[model samples]
Target: MKLKKGINIIDQHDKFGFYCNGKFGGNFVAETARKPIEDLSKLFEKLRRSKKFLKKRDFYFKHYLGGETPFFKLNNLTKYLGGAQIWCKDVSAINGDAHKAYHATVNALICKESGKKFIAGDTGAGMFGKNLALAAKEMKLSAKIFMGTKDISRQAPNVKFMREAGAEVVPVDSGSKTLVDAVSECMRHYVSNCDTTHLAVGSAIGANIFLKICAWSTSQISRELKRQLIKEFGEIPKLKLINVIGGGSSALGFWNEFIDYDKKHVELIGVEAKYAAPLATNAKVAILHGAAQYCLTDKEGQIAETHSLSAGLDYPGSSPLHGLLKDTKRARYTLASDKEALNAFKLVSKLENLRPSLEPAHAWSECIRIAPKLKKSDVIVVNNCGKGYKDKKIYIENIGYYPE
Candidate 1:
């Protein structure tokens, strides 16, 4: 538990820490901007008694980056979209069905290693909720899931899985009865249950542990993308832009390591739901619920809202790191509506025979919109977040059926 020179413990008791670069004022808590000693080992030891979560430091790496995920060239998509070239980092097939599994599984491990009794989380019954439940069962830990009534009503498939996985699903009927309300209710629960529960943030927000795990989990795509592009094209082409966002974990998973890259060569885009646009609507930083660091919130204290068909993106704010990226003008932020997201979802299913998670496809939808404006020689990588298995029933129920 001795203090390390370059590593800063972001969460003292959770063994959540990050490496600090000398620049940008070194490492410190985003709220107090205070540095802490490196005592993660002691914290890890204390948490190791749980026997439900992971005690192994390399578990995440072994599980996430250990396998070969598809990184395929989008010959058909590029021609279809009329872009230079399109490629997908196929996170759709990650364990438990979504890229969120990468983060959730690691988080459950962290919760177990931290001696946390139970894992609590909120969801719209999307990949995040399902992944957490799956991970909890895999780790032999109990899980409490807060989801919106509407999400439960709509996302029945995921609800079944959550129940099957032994998760206690609490439905939020308050407020909008949607993703936002579910997250709010979950935060309220976490605040009251903080002593015994470790709120496993679905994405790279909420707690520092998410950022660490996501950075490592999603880095596989970026690393593979670079290698694949090089092998295919004989060189690492200028990464004109990379677009995706969530609690900012998905984007951060790829973008965090490349923070210092040449800004002119690569562009980063963080897409938000049009109804809950934190980066675009609330540029001024504020602390979001359940966190000490600043985030995007409205004057009324709601997370800046966005509108999207994807329940996964119903949050009002981006992670503070995303806020920092936005403030520094290091990333471009955009908004897409539910209509656009649904269109993209259907388009992907029809064209690629791939039904992506609504969230990642939301970002890809923007890429499709912008493709015509780009040069034909350019290349783009889209984070294909999750499979649409959980969403198919809802799609069928709402739209009747897909055309053959």
Candidate 2:
């Protein structure tokens, strides 16, 4: 692919060095960079004037991207939990059943602008794959999704959705037969098909350039949350923003605007599955999936096998910015075991009539742990990142009954 003007060229080694006006700009990192849109007024003005922006905005609106999702005040659940005004940002209401729909839409837009004909990537629970397939289909581009065999089994519904959306699903059996292996297979595929295909990374975990793009795309979540909070509470209310972290895109999206908000006003909590809690356990930094980050590894630095009831959270490494947040104490990292998550899943479904994917159920477990101790005046906002439809069969098999 020919390099576009003002866009940096990313080599096969994944070294991202930006160049603008014939001068080398330093490598991009989340901590040092400003938020995506510093001035909303200027951004709106530019969007209004640019034909390309207008076209993309039309596409986004048609597909329900860049729009407000359901923000519910969970009064009954809050009463049951006995503390905090609990609010849930229901990303599951989005078209692809997850926040990843926004990511995939933005990725497709980028590829369309670049004149790419094919979009391909790796997925865990298949949420990203389904989203990508939907976007690619809408854009008249072909899609190929690499998924782990284990994830394919657990996420059968999502796999079927991807195929229905015109994506070719390829099962990967390398490594631990999970996300890491899927990523490896996708990278190899990209190497062979780089000219015609654009890799649509599912998370904020990749080369620096890819991470920057993901963070910028997912910033819509925080922007919408801020607007909704003001409308609901008469102002941006002080609250605890709770999210589950696999590759950290959802957590980053939820907390992006609040990163510079008063730390005392907003406490960011990122929960991980107990079996894949690298950040919670302070694991060593290592290179995985083209980025150096906290990874669960053995004595020889090989990626360790991870298990989680939620296929989405069963990853060996996390986004690099998450490690920075943990190191700087900007965000607190915690873990919830399968038992705790499943119990919260059942409790939330019964009390709230919301069947959240097990990924965000980990965040709900953390909320269950901490909400009771907090004052009633306090607020907690949970990102219900995805719906539980794909995991229903797995849940029934594990618990031996349907959740009432």
Candidate 3:
């Protein structure tokens, strides 16, 4: 497929990051972002260890959601790999049964705290939308979820959950009818509706401020991970953190607490779905969906359409934070084709007796490739980013079965 029917260029020297109101160097908010960018930027700063907000978030995530998520070993897979010890940071048990719950709750609470009655957001595989809708309900706010029509079909369970929670789901039929388009629709709505609606970005992508908000919500994961790691191994071991990166909420979160450690000691690996692998494919640095980051763009600089078996990973752009990491060589990215991810899903489900969403399946695909090469002293942690129950149709169609 000739993307946009133009020459395909690989941009290896591109810088990955964005500026907000001269906050980070070059404030480059898009026209659609003018209204809320400043406020959201301020909100990001205000949320830094603020007692009231942190207390509220803790109540919501702990007593309301569940307690801390479990980080445990995959004994069967570890033994099967026969080299590195493999483990799972299971975010699937989050309140919304996905990592998006963290961002959804945080941003939605931000909305309520700001006295906004409505939350506007977007989703790909529908998990974000579902979680945002649930957050809106809990916070006594209304929600509008923009999702591609194609995603609405594949992610019916989440769509149903969103509507049942009283969120309005708008289906974008244009473009690829996927995540990027849904993101565009949501942001465009923000331009006109910022007064009463807070843009609750459900992942660590999109506009710079939104990215900060999402990343902040997920930082708790890595903090908990640190404690779990110490408890599990008696100390932090030579480890690799591998996770599937769509918008990168989970991957970034999985690594956040450990980022201060030396890369030689704690390696970070990101697995992107093949066609949607901007980091792996060497995408150009461009402003897409309001953030300057590695984007799969046509010659005209317009976002190119991307595809993946996993709806959550289907996007033309990636998180700007990921771009900066790539530029600095702190984190490396790899690609997992749909076939490999599906096969990984089958392998893990049968061996480990766990059902993984397709996104994490991509990480498992990478683990399968590299696990045998590492020494037994090295530990590999793959993030289980979402609940597999939402992928019932995907499992039935691709793998012939969906675990009960």
Candidate 4:
């Protein structure tokens, strides 16, 4: 389990830890930050094994991130489809209107506990950056956010929120200048500054420690979903959960709780942007973001550039957790093009009177596509992981109109 120092971070990425071995992820932490980060992993594992029902995260979810979100049955969408029952896991009410806060807040708390003065991390659509900033502020810790320049422009709303919350937003100009670059720079920055910083990875991704921590924190979603399902129907109904796949945090969180159930009982489906799909495309295994995973690679086997109208989903690879799920056939991955997402965004806005962020709109689009094929007793819950407020500009720009 001994890992050598990660090297040539700005160039060669394979020196980061391999995904399979019991090694530190990314091998990316500095000597100073290593113990603290390792302590964090231990802390999360301890709480996870506690019999207190994960009460700490539960408290944060309610008060800090806006209590247990609703599992509202989409009456209009269901009636419109006329096949399966559709439900919306409304995460829009959470802080930053996304599930990023689920892990960000807890990570900031852990930073404070570790006596760190700052929490540093990266963002894609900017929700994670904003959430990290807000969490640090609430914990009275300094925050630094790294975001790719491309994301800064399209996700201005969250960028503004991050700055307004008193966090320094560093624009990454490297590589594609999008999420992948932001993650690289953030982890690199942590290497030099880990004396007082804990890397706050936003999604269920990155090196093994990061992937485990983020996924563990976001698992709060499915925890709530499981409880809400019983309360809603007085028993768990035939269910299929659909969530957008970026780094696969939210989707993993949404699906993990139900994963133990029989596939014939609670099915899980993950939706990815058509052009950015790694798992959905059944991509070949490769290294990305310091770990082994599936990615869309070019003919030369380098990770391919990905395209998605949703800034959050505009990445070439997903978490190894997803790769395992896909390979095991426990979860299914599918694609939805930008046009289909745009259409679903507008259509659902009109039908449900709910404005969905483009990220989750992809998930909704997949739900819209498959609901018509299921039986009437089947229940479909789509993770509306973000609100549309942050996407108003992008939405209007693409469709020339945003629904009122």
Leading candidate by TM-score: 3
Q: What TM-score would every model get versus the actual structure? A: 0.80, 0.87, 0.93, 0.90
**What TM-score does candidate 3 get on C-alpha atoms?**
0.93
Task: Report the number of clashing residue pairs per model.
Answer: 17, 0, 0, 0
TM-score winner, 1 or 2: 2
Estimate, for each residue in 363-393, the C-alpha lDDT of model 3 and write its tens digit: 9999999999999898999888888888878
Which is the leading candidate under lDDT?
3
Give model 4's TM-score versus the native structure: 0.90
lDDT score at residue 238, model 1, on the 0-100 scale: 61
Superior candidate under lDDT, 1 versus 4: 4
Off by over 4 Å in 2: 1-51, 58-66
Quick one: ranking by lDDT, best first?
3, 4, 2, 1
lDDT of each: 0.64, 0.79, 0.83, 0.82
Model 1 residue 384 lDDT score: 78
* RMSD of every prediction: 6.0, 7.4, 6.3, 5.8
Total clashes for model 1: 17
